[model samples]
Target: MGMKYSDGFSKQLPTLATVGAALVSLYLMSQAMKSIPVGTAYSIWTGIGALGVATLGIFLFGDRASAPRLACIGLIVAGVIGL
Candidate 1:
């Protein structure tokens, strides 16, 4: 019974995470769009999301931290800053 509960909880984790992310993203985007160009806001939002996911993958999921990957991440941040 304990194993079944744990398995069910694990299965729901992704769904919960997705919903939480979406809600926060929507709220942030709406707030940002009020003061910035939609294109700029969206670009920055996506850039931040990509960088965050990459960092999490590297630290939590043991993703490869290759030079090219790090360089690309830097480029993304630079692009966001350029905006």
Candidate 2:
């Protein structure tokens, strides 16, 4: 979203994509909250999103991969599972 807004002319496509992603995220969160505690649902959602984004960054964007980063992702997964 920040990236989309950083464009001086307000890039419509990036803005729309960001908005769409946010809406879908909210809808999924609402649905998940129906069966899970709000904290648990939110944490799980955040963990998954973070891990996914990090993985994509490493694979597609050439973000440097490090052992600590992988360990942290594992920890996030464990925490989510523990919830």
Candidate 2: tens digits of C-alpha lDDT, residues 45-76: 99888888888788877888899998998998
lDDT of 2 at 55: 84
List per-prediction Cα lDDT, in the order shown. Answer: 0.83, 0.82
Query: Per model, how many backbone clashes are there?
Result: 0, 0
- What is the lDDT, from 0 to 100, of the residue 14 in candidate 2? 72
Tens-place lDDT per residue, model 1, 1-83, is 22233465576766566667678889989999999999999999999988988888898768999999999999999999999
TM-score of 2: 0.82
- The 10-residue segment of model 1 with minimum total lDDT is 1-10
Q: List the candidate 2 regions with Cα displacement exceeding 4 Å.
A: 1-9
Error of 1 at 26 (Å): 0.9
Highest-scoring model, TM-score: 2
Model 2 residue 72 lDDT? 90
